[model samples]
Target: MSFRESVATATVSRSVHFFPLHLRRDLVRQAAEDLDRYHGKAAADYWRSTCRGLAADLTAKGCSDDEMREQIMDFQAAVQVALLEMHREQLAQG
Candidate 1:
């Protein structure tokens, strides 16, 4: 299903929520660092901790858990798409 279609079908996904501009700018940097640091062979616990940290950060920033879940889900989708594109580019270059 298209991103729009899926989001439209889900009640909580009705809108794209962005962080405050400066915080938004930091998000990609944070995600990259967290993913790079936490992702690896046998790194399940590491990744889980990273996700927990992210949720904590959201909570500290005053996002409700439901709101955090919705936004994080959307963020994950975007990150997956970005990773796919990077992989495709690497394969093409190779």
Candidate 2:
């Protein structure tokens, strides 16, 4: 499936659901902005490492692969939306 399709169908993981909604939104927004600051391979590398780190962290906290998968998918969708909004705002300001 396409990234957009996957994102559109993404669900919040139970593990991540423990976090308050505001905190989750803040984390995703900050991560999205950080990822968007990079160019070319740097961006790809950052995203890969971020996902790996997230998986590792969740695993350490005793989360299952299914939970990790959902969290990752949810995170990806949130970041993509955040980045799109950022770009839209930038264009509007210019």
Candidate 3:
């Protein structure tokens, strides 16, 4: 399956029942933003590692892979927005 598909599936299966939908989305978005901030290939590796860790944790708690992915996506999105805001602030300061 494609990466997005896998993530979506994992999210649905693992996390949907635990968190409210909006919170889950926010968590995944934050994770994505953090992953994007790293230098070079490290960013990709960080995201992969983070996702794997999250998946494992969720599974241990009886969550499905789909839920884990969803949470990560939410975190990523939140991070992205925060990063953008920080950049803007920095620009304003300069």
Each candidate structure's count of clashing pairs: 0, 0, 37
lDDT score at residue 72, model 2, on the 0-100 scale: 80
Instruction: Provide the lDDT at 58 for model 2.
Output: 77
Candidate 1 Cα deviation (angstroms), residue 44: 2.9
Local accuracy of candidate 2 as per-residue lDDT tens digits, 1-94: 9987777667443334334222488788888899999989999999999888987887787777887787787788888989999999999999
Write down the RMSD of candidate 3 (Cα, Å). 11.6
Sort by TM-score, top down from the best: 2, 1, 3
1-94: candidate 3 lDDT, tens digit per residue: 9999999998877633565323565555566467657977898788678767866776787766777678666655666676677678779999
Name the regions of candidate 3 deviating beyond 4 angstroms.
Answer: 1-37
Q: How would you encode candidate 1's per-residue C-alpha lDDT over 47-91 as one tens digit per residue?
A: 466567777887787687798877666665555555566567779
Global Cα lDDT for candidate 1:
0.62
| Strongest candidate by TM-score | 2
CA lDDT, candidate 3, residue 26? 55
Each model's TM-score, in the order given?
A: 0.56, 0.74, 0.55
lDDT of the candidates, in the order given: 0.62, 0.79, 0.67
